[model samples]
Target: MSGDDGESTIQRIQDIVAVFVLSITAVLTAWCGFEASKWGGEMSIAFSQASSARIQSTAAEGEAQSARQLDLSVYTLWIGAKADEDDRLADYVEARFTPWFTPAYEAWVADGMVENSPFAREEYVPPGTEEAVELSETADEKFAAALENNQRGDDYSLLTVMFALVLFLTAMSQRDVKTWVGRALLGMAVVLDIVGIAILLTFPIKI
Candidate 1:
């Protein structure tokens, strides 16, 4: 072929290659953007959940504290009832204390006569304490889950930034350098973009 024809053929081939590279880079960029957006939304939701869980935990802790105070009051009442010499006063205090104890303990008190009885000294777990503890534990679990989701979101964001860089490099390859160096840079960018996309796919998508 003539020199001019050969030049035309080479130019056409370069145009085709540039178009292919640009197209793939555009698609990858869009995909990375979408994934990053999804991750950001999920991260926000996770953080919100964590905040709500903390609030619930705080409320439960307050309830637990109140129950402990009530238990202490009951103990003091029982002690006063035991020290009283008048039977009627002792009976009145015992009746007031009955509502504070659990049903099982109330039954024990009724059968054993708690004043000066062996069962009177037995530890009493106030109502609501167990439920409060369970709420606190649930809050901890939710917080941990939120942290994990946030980390995943960060990872996806980093990959999305990397994909943006790939798009920049590929676009520059078309205009800045006309030699083998340009092709080499484009090749490297394509490889990096593919790797980033693979990693993004491996992460579980929320919503």
Candidate 2:
């Protein structure tokens, strides 16, 4: 081929590659931005759930504490009545024991009373104790999910930046420059695009 024809062929090929890069990079950048926004919404929802669960946990814990105090007061009264050898008063106090405290008190008495108090017994699970524990665990899970969502959002944002750079490089490759400079920019853009896509493939996708 003649020199002019060879140059024309190279220019055509470069234009084709640049067009391809621009098209694909633009799409990828939009996709990354969309994913980042979705993940940010997920993070916000997880954080809200965590906060709600934490509030429920605190409320349950307060209820449990209140129940424990009530049991303690009744038991203390029973102890005083028994020490005074007032069987009638002791019996009345024993009858007044809340349902939750009854099983633990019975178990302690059966075990010959405790250096480990009735409250220490496994049977001593007060009202709301289980709820408090479960709610606290839920709060922790939601908090962890929120953090993971935030990280994923950040990852997508970084990918968006990378794609923006790819677009920049691809556009610059078409500028009036030396042949080697154009090829170098195009090659770098292509490499970065491939790398960004590979990384995106490894990430978990959200709608």
Candidate 3:
């Protein structure tokens, strides 16, 4: 072929390659976007369940604290030894608190908070085993806050990941695309992806 014809052929080939890349990117972007949408639905359900569990956990912990207080008061009244009333109160408190303790500890265990199954402290002893129960409201409050934060964080992390995936799909769609409107959209998509990446990197996972 002539020199000019060869150059024309090369230019045509380049244009074809650009169009192919754009088309492939558009298709991949659409696929990833669908996956992200599916993930978003699952994340929503998981969040709702975690929220319900949190509310229930709070209520149960409150009941356990109350039981512990009663056990303490009864122990003090008996003094230096076990009395029938003290034993009865202790048993009652144990009954009321066991369910709460078991579930709360189990949750911690499931989240890898505790190393031992059926975990308990070696020195752990409830009220009526010795003296009046010394209530540390701060400890319980901190624990509740931790649990809440952990759950909230997990939910948010999952959501943010899905969002990031969606943005990635958008970015793929925009890359190497052409058209005045397409260019504008591509710019917006790049900005969104950057913001999404920033969010994912800046925030710590709750757990």
Candidate 4:
């Protein structure tokens, strides 16, 4: 071929390569944006759940504290009645305490307290205390999830920003630099874009 024709062929090849690189970069940018948005939404939901769980835990804790005070009052009244030999007062104390007793302790009492009473040894928990502890644990789990989702969202956003950089470099390669250096920059941008896309695919979308 003539020199002019050869140069034309090379120019056409470069144009084709540049177009391909730009197209792929555009797709990668869009994908990264979607992933970042998804992660951000998940983070928000997790934060809301964590806040609600924390509120529930706090309320349960308050109820548990109040119940503990009542338990203490009942125990003190029972002791006072027994010490004073007031049968009627002791009966009233027993009746008030019955609702707080666990089913096993109640059964033991029904069996005439022949064996060591679990209630007497204070082995059982109050009704709401266990639930309060569970709520607190749920709150902790939700908070942890929110933190993790927030970090992942940040990572995705950073990747999206990197993809934007890759697009800028690739576009610059066509106009600012037209030699081998420009082709090398385009190649590097293509590689970076591919790697970013792969990472974006690995992350799961929540909701």
Candidate models: Cα lDDT each: 0.69, 0.94, 0.49, 0.77
Q: Comparing candidate 3 with candidate 4, which one achieves the higher TM-score?
A: 4
Better lDDT candidate (2, 3): 2
lDDT per residue, candidate 3, 26-55, as tens digits?
554444445445444555555555555555
For residues 26-138, what per-residue lDDT tens digits would candidate 1 score against the true structure?
77667656766776777677677767767776787777678767656765666676677566766765666534465545666666755553235444445555666676677
Model 2, residue 42: C-alpha shift (Å): 0.4
lDDT of candidate 4 over 79-105, digit per residue (tens): 699899998998887777736554545
The per-prediction CA RMSD against the true structure, in angstroms, equals: 4.1, 0.9, 13.6, 3.2
Best by TM-score: 2
Mind giving the per-residue lDDT tens digits that candidate 2 earns over 6-121?
99999899899999999999999999999999999999999999999999999999999999999999999999998999999999999999999999999999999954679989
Off by over 4 Å in 4: 2-4, 102-123, 176-178
Runs in model 2 lying further than 4 Å from the true structure:
none
Alpha-carbon runs more than 4 Å astray in model 3? 80-207
- How does candidate 4 score on lDDT? 0.77
Root mean square deviation (Cα) for candidate 3: 13.6
Q: State the displacement of the C-alpha of residue 29, model 2, in Å, after optimal TM-score superposition.
A: 0.4
- The Cα RMSD of model 4 versus the native structure comes to 3.2
Which candidate, 1 or 3, would have the higher TM-score against the true structure?
1
